[model samples]
Target: MSNNVLKNLKPYEVFKYFEEITQIPRGSGNEKGISDYLVAFAKEHNLEVIQDEALNVIIKKPGTAGYEGAPTIVLQGHMDMVNEKNQGTEHDFDKDPLKLRVEGDMLYATGTTLGADNGIAMAYAMALLASKDIAHPPVEALMTTDEEAGMSGAMALNPEHINGRILINIDSEEEGKLLVSCAGGVRVSVTLPIKWEDIKEDKTPIVIRLRGLKGGHSGMEIHKGRGNSNKIMGRILYDLQDRVSYNLCSLNGGAKNNAIPREADAVLLVNKEDVEGLKAVASSWNEVLKNELKASDPDVNVQVEVLPDRYNKMFSKETTKKAVQLLYLIPSGIQTMSMEIAGLVQSSTNLGVVTTSKDMITYDSATRSSVKTLKEDLVNQFKLLAEVVGVECETRADYPDWQYDADSKIRRVFERVYKEMTGNDPEIVAIHAGVECGLFKEKFGEMDMISFGPNLYDVHTPDEHISISSTERMWNYLIAVLKEIK
Candidate 1:
């Protein structure tokens, strides 16, 4: 089954490059293949290109005709995509190409992310660079790596390598909305050691699983009030501690540090007689959870299954108590709402992933805020929570926020062109999620920047998709903006 549905799409060159990109695996931290491919494309087109040590690619194209004297414009987007899939998708993002499909006006992949968040930016840049008729200024197309995991490529870039003073970032998700600023973020990891013990006499093994929740991008969808599976499991375990005697064997959930967890599972050893009681408790909690999240997650499921084989080892009673307490106490979801912006989320955290190993259990979270002091405060909060439980916590991949520029020349050009084309003004606003524009601004203080993209839904999740008609419209709008540049 070839995922070549874009062959007959309109705006042939844009979709053509997108189709080619989808055939390559370019997940974060594994972008060498795609970076090399971009270099090869530039070479084939007889253009100047650079592939940095961090695998970031920059392709330079001369301006066309009368536009040769115009100022150079930088077209920026990341080459990496978040690799997320359903529980049993059987697809390997590190090796297999995405399985693309078209339904109505949208394009999506089977049981996985479509990567359109930034991939379409690369496609648009490539198409424009390869064109001979489109009027534009000198172009520098910058494709970065490891952006989903962190802004490592952007962080590694030297300011001297880029000469463009006007930058247009192609990483936003909504159409007709120009992003002027964005929040900063960091990844936090906490580890707690536990002691293991032999299971007591006549104890049975059982598994509790939560699934079917509508997980989404942690930063963008945090305010949606959807249920977090890890949090749900914590409540269940806390309730079971008083009703039934059990020993925890293993606990795990979630994949990315930037996505809300949709599924979580736990294994436990309980006395044979307590199995039925645990099931009843799980059922009761399921009903309660459904009622609590009915408006957001209508399809949430909670299941319990008993195993024939018994587990030989389990966490000590003290360890079990501390683990449950940690999950219950740690902060997750929206922490604050913007008082200035009408409906924007100000500060937030996602308790993204949890895992257990032989010596320790680890919790990974992503926190974001536009205020530098508030972002640091959230990290301190996480550290304090871990300290109380005698665990260790650390932060990584800290990126700065992009502040809005009220006097940006490039933004004015974009707004003027959008209104002339659509007969309506585009909404200009700031986003809560992290974008690479912040790193660019830090490196080049005088550069003017703005971010925009086509309409996309459920980004960073399995249900991610891009609208075909909106993509064509965005392509036209980008071309119009380029023509207006001076």
Candidate 2:
């Protein structure tokens, strides 16, 4: 705390805790360091805390004065962040603390993702628990883990551990907007078998790369019209089926199953006589992609690079056809829009990751839909594709969507108090992205929850940043809401 980047910022305790925790790496599936740090912080403050097997931390504080009898208000947020960085970023999510930079009104991490999506929730909960003057009810801080990758932490939380009926999730992006409902989601992966054979004719190995697209959170930015590298690569190869003689050796791209893939590459063994023809297609395809994505992703690039080393094995013709067919046939991007809520995406899928192995190639996708039937329909579509293409498809982390509650007490309290404080009504809406709230709802059936936070932009991307002024505003609003609850 001696030379903290955000030590002097307003709401000193919140920023102070935020900086301290940022010093600990808390990427998805690697949460022990930060989880232990949280337990230590709770002990330092003398709060009752519980650390579960999944590294989910729950710290309990008794209500202040007359509010001791008030129902427990759960302050919930995940502990892990999506570990995403720029291609040339010189930072490690495993050990390095985020390099903080404050610009005008926004706070960003240089070349890496700032963990403010849910880290701010921890900071706010810490401030609430540590405050001596602020009034509040019995507070339970439910800090789970691995939310960006999946809802495993939240799913593993024991229901008997919580006595809170009112849950205020501080994981939303916009400050003044209250998220009442969110789309449910599941992670689906398709593994296709590939047959390898020795190349008979001498062929030139060339790598076709697609990059520079503005990739983002699949659910949040799916309607943005950004290019999906995996899908685009499939289209390229499919197009070349007639013009060139080639066999795919390997194709891979993307890191996370929930983030839109920004870059992808495919290695092809082309006949020596057809090398120029493949390069010609690559050049023409590059222009086509640029023109199509000019408004949404102007920097989109597609290039072919000649490999110096030679590849001995190439995918069999039958295997290659199945692979390209599976990639091109899979459904992606916006599928449906809400009729009740204008401009809201109701159903969508993201082709997030592509990888090749010794005998199989896998494609991972995240499917989100607010409607249960629609979500099921989307998964069935993939299953049908797998049946036709002769591949294996599996789904996991299936969570339901949170439905709207008309008599939400916590929401009313927030709306009324926020209006009184800012002289304007906060925007009330539902998001297409998945949050832990849905899983919590499944765990506690009677849970009444609302999700909101400060202004965060470009989540799950290296350009992610949070608004400074919005944080201060949110802090004040949360404090007021806690006091008013009783």
Error of 1 at 168 (Å): 0.3
TM-scores of the candidates in the order shown: 0.77, 0.80
Record all residue pairs in model 1 with backbone atoms less than 3 Å apart, i.e. clashing. none
Q: Candidate 2: which stretches are off by over 4 Å?
A: 1-48, 62-69, 79-119, 130-133, 146-152, 201-208, 243-246, 267-283, 301-312, 397-400, 403-407, 455-472
lDDT of 1 by residue, 192-250 (tens): 79899976577888999999899998987888999998988999999998999988988
> Lowest summed-lDDT stretch of 10 residues in model 1?
1-10
> What is candidate 2's lDDT per residue for 111-204, written digit by digit as tens?
9899997899999999898899999999999999988877789988999999999999999888789999889988899999889999888889
- In angstroms, the error of model 2 at 154 is 2.2
Q: Candidate 2: lDDT over CA atoms?
A: 0.90
- Highest lDDT: which candidate? 2
